[model samples]
Target chain A: MGGDFGPGITVPASLDCLRNNPDLKLILVGDSTILNQHLGENLSVFKDRLTVHHASQQVEMHESPSKALKNKKDSSMRVAINLVHEGLADACVSAGNTGALMATARFVLKMIPGIDRPGIISALPSVFGHTHVLDLGANVDCTAEHLYQFAVMGNELVKAVENIESPRVGLLNIGEEDVKGNEQVKTAAKLLENSSLNYIGYVEGNSLNAGNIKVDLIVCDGFVGNVALKSIEGAAKMISTLLKEDFSKNIFTKLAGLIAYPVLRSFKDRIDPRLYNGASFLGLKGLVIKSHGGADALAFKTAIEIAEIEVKQDVIRRISEQVEKSLTLSKSA
Target chain B: MGGDFGPGITVPASLDCLRNNPDLKLILVGDSTILNQHLGENLSVFKDRLTVHHASQQVEMHESPSKALKNKKDSSMRVAINLVHEGLADACVSAGNTGALMATARFVLKMIPGIDRPGIISALPSVFGHTHVLDLGANVDCTAEHLYQFAVMGNELVKAVENIESPRVGLLNIGEEDVKGNEQVKTAAKLLENSSLNYIGYVEGNSLNAGNIKVDLIVCDGFVGNVALKSIEGAAKMISTLLKEDFSKNIFTKLAGLIAYPVLRSFKDRIDPRLYNGASFLGLKGLVIKSHGGADALAFKTAIEIAEIEVKQDVIRRISEQVEKSLTLSKSA
Candidate 1:
């Protein structure tokens, strides 16, 4: 994985991955010493399945993506992406620096055919179970066409991940009206309305969390999607903080907390960022799951599971077919 | 007030406003019959203080700002703005259509001297109390200059409403780094850095909810602010829904709920959106409060109290001073 916390998180995740999927193979592409220190005495069972490749440098999270890729030849992120490029690894997962990971992926794996930009697709745990929020942090300034492509990619991803036959796709707009939002959103609505996908025109921001809107996939510019995703996380954090403060207020509240403990735990588990950290750097040639950098073992294991599923589903191949067909039709039209 | 619910909410709020400030005079501007119908028996104590304007047209929530203003000549919103325009009302408070209200205010009251777009400013309840979030739903395609003006306006509003000195204003960017985010954010950051205001430079999306980023005021495009605001509401709704579902799951949980009723009520009271529904449409010539349309009497009362404080503080004069200074400096520079 291409991240600052590559081996720190990956070591535990690798262990959990092997335990959960006995046949899974893991190639540690970071500094062998650091990886071994974490791996330690538990390396006996998966010795045959594990391979260590020495990658000396680690990319800092704040480093410029292009500069990091250019300077750090043996960086863990670059090494991992190379492995995927060379067909040595089925998929690559990272919780490290997002920009560096995205940059390296774009540079090494390259964009899939007919894809304009490699959008980051995140799964937000909505009331309707799960909604795929696309372009969470990929294309900041997106056009109408870019959003259209995002819908296509997001739709394909929903199907691959959620096992939906035809996941409903909604264009994120200011309102449900035919004419709402900025020029880009208005144009995107028109394009989405004309698209072959299960298009549910414009959707308001409230529909995302309410899960009242039946769409499994919601597409928008990275600016809006990223803000929306982070806002939800921030709100959840704020609410949890408030609840904790309330519970710790007095003896009565504390005692009440004991009684309400199960419900609070369920709330935490349901909206936990760690549990829902398997974001894909979608539209890339190879499968890449970007888990939260601070994700614990459970979350990391989930990311691995997601990666494995994407590989089995031949997600890239299917996406390529759909995108290419759509592109060809657009060109002809 | 400019809204339909203003009469319903304002009648009780007028009492609270009067109780707090005996000198407060409420010119209830709406359909006289409807206002009296709602205020019936409760009008005795403050019957002498209330003056009604018979406005017939009510702007629908879905109507376009311009269309609503052009078509609905005798709208309560239009009349409310006109009161400010003719120097009859100190401010206009509304729980009506935000778009129509904004349009009416812009057309009648006009922008404060240097303000390009009068932003919709409101204090969003954050983990760390409250932060002033501007452009809640006013200007959509905001330029950097527009955002800078919003910062100035937001800084003034926070000072007026919250009694904070030198409220640190932050430009809502994709990342905190000077190098991150789209061109608009970058441009806005530069303007903020160079401005005379207490500009804190860039802040991330997550910071808006985290309550850790210690800035009193945050300025961004309406799209980002609206999306972020709605997402927070969505998260809260989703969690609340989940909480209700889990509580109603079994007899035991239901029993726990009954036992912890008082504590839960306290928790609900603390986080209730009803108590925090007064959002000010900043940058106009006069103060305009936009309460939630679904507001009850309690929320409406709070809205009136909010309006009283806003008018007492002379928010418009303060905003005018800041904007005038900004305009003169920019022109000379």
Candidate 2:
């Protein structure tokens, strides 16, 4: 239900998911022909277990979020969200247009009880293990309240999925000081301080990559988070270009690379987004995970693994319980 | 002058600058003793060519920008800024705290006559040649006027240093549409449209690393720019780690690395940021380049090269002229 390209990537990903988990079933919410072309000749094998619901229209990559959702009634993403809304699917996944998907979910799925604007939380590979960076590209200009909510949601998601108790949450600021960043962070810090979450105060950019912060969740505005995500992708490309260049420089370093191959693979897996590809759109009624568009079979297989973990964890149920508890406690206090 | 590590990193970098450029002369601003310890042999060779001034205090990295500037009276960073302010030095370079350095320059060196808050500009090695990302962690939040000013400064700097006749300037946004992004981007778009600069309208994150945009400068708030920059760094590290693993897997790839060393070095040089280490703080009266604290000799050398180019091109002069021209035209219109 994400975008035009969702069916192409998702079909292959869904096949991998089915192969890994024998009991798993897939309900494809896309044009049948395109989905079939990508699913290969094993179409009949997946019959009974797989269902393809016809969806003709698609939200464009650059289409305005609201207009796309409002105008395109039977769009795959919208229909997918509706499926979740109607209690048809356990979770919905999309890799198409982020804005359109988020918009459709908000307009159709509606915000969960106390949740404001739902945030896109992705696990970034850091030196100190996995760090969850929220608001990947949902709301560009986030308020203090939005950031506070992001912290709570991020903490809950990590706790439920990763099975961590009292995850440390850090507000992404320019520097470490409580008053270091702009008005938003300064105000957000106050909310975080007052909230029930384990707020670790302000964290800087460099520390985001370092293993020192000891925090599980890092909350930031979508603009910053999105830029950070893209920057990492660009940087990875640059490094690959450099590595290839270095290997081709002469004979010695190429030989060194040979000796360093095993160590290199270990390092790659440590930071591979494929190992950390599944991004959960928290605060929704049902669990939703967005995998990278360019994810190969292995990466897609890993995404399914992540989805299984989230679904089994009853993430949405836990979130609802937490929200209810908070509301009750607030009224009592 | 910027941070405590500035001297440790800068002295060697300055020495490299002198070593590389025989015509270059250095005026070291800090404690004469420590400066001499690092530059003793080089100092004797340069003799009267190199001069060191005594400064007792140093600015800590974690200090708040305002407090650091206000309280650290005898700090070397303050002294360095004062040198530029009083016309003692043509430009300043630091690898210390960026916020404090910007604060010191704005308060001490002052804005370039008509310029507003000073912006930080770093030329990232993008797939589309070198992409200039401006306001990189300088002003976290800015008005429309600030962005317009950034465009002006970015254009002038790019033209003077990069030699791009009319470098493309794109307003960084969530989408490429004229109506996308927050209120700040919308307001800035209007200002950019009326400006004398070559504004390429809006650019999204995907277009940032790609050459498809045909833009030289990508302008955004310090928060976005900084996150983007750091994310790229993190991503590059991740990819390099992965590539190393792949190459080390077996003997064939190891042998290939040995055979392809020259080509590898060429490619490495193309993407290595150490080849372009310094981040210029634009819109200031004098030049201020902030290099990485962990910058090695190669990185320092690159920073020195940047400083030389910036100084020789008279970037400050071009920026001042552009700012003045833009302001005058706006007022008249």
Estimated TM-score per prediction? Answer: 0.96, 0.88
Candidate 1 residue A207 C-alpha distance from true site, Å? 2.4
TM-score of 1: 0.96
- Summarize candidate 1's per-residue lDDT along B253-313 as a digit string, tens digits: 8987776777778777887877777888877777788887778777877777778888899
Question: How does the DockQ of candidate 2 come out?
Answer: 0.36
- Determine which window of 10 residues in candidate 1 chain A has minimal summed lDDT: A1-10
Which stretches of candidate 1 lie above 4 Å from their native place? Answer: A1-6, B1-21
The local lDDT score (0 to 100) that residue B26 gets in candidate 2 is 78
Candidate 2 regions exceeding 4 Å error are: A1-8, A32-44, A55-62, A206-214, A245-278, A291-305, A327-333, B1-9, B37-44, B206-214, B240-270, B296-298
- Candidate 2 per-residue lDDT, tens place, A111-219, comes to 6787777888878776666788998877888888788778877888899877899998988876676656889889989878887888888876544565355678999
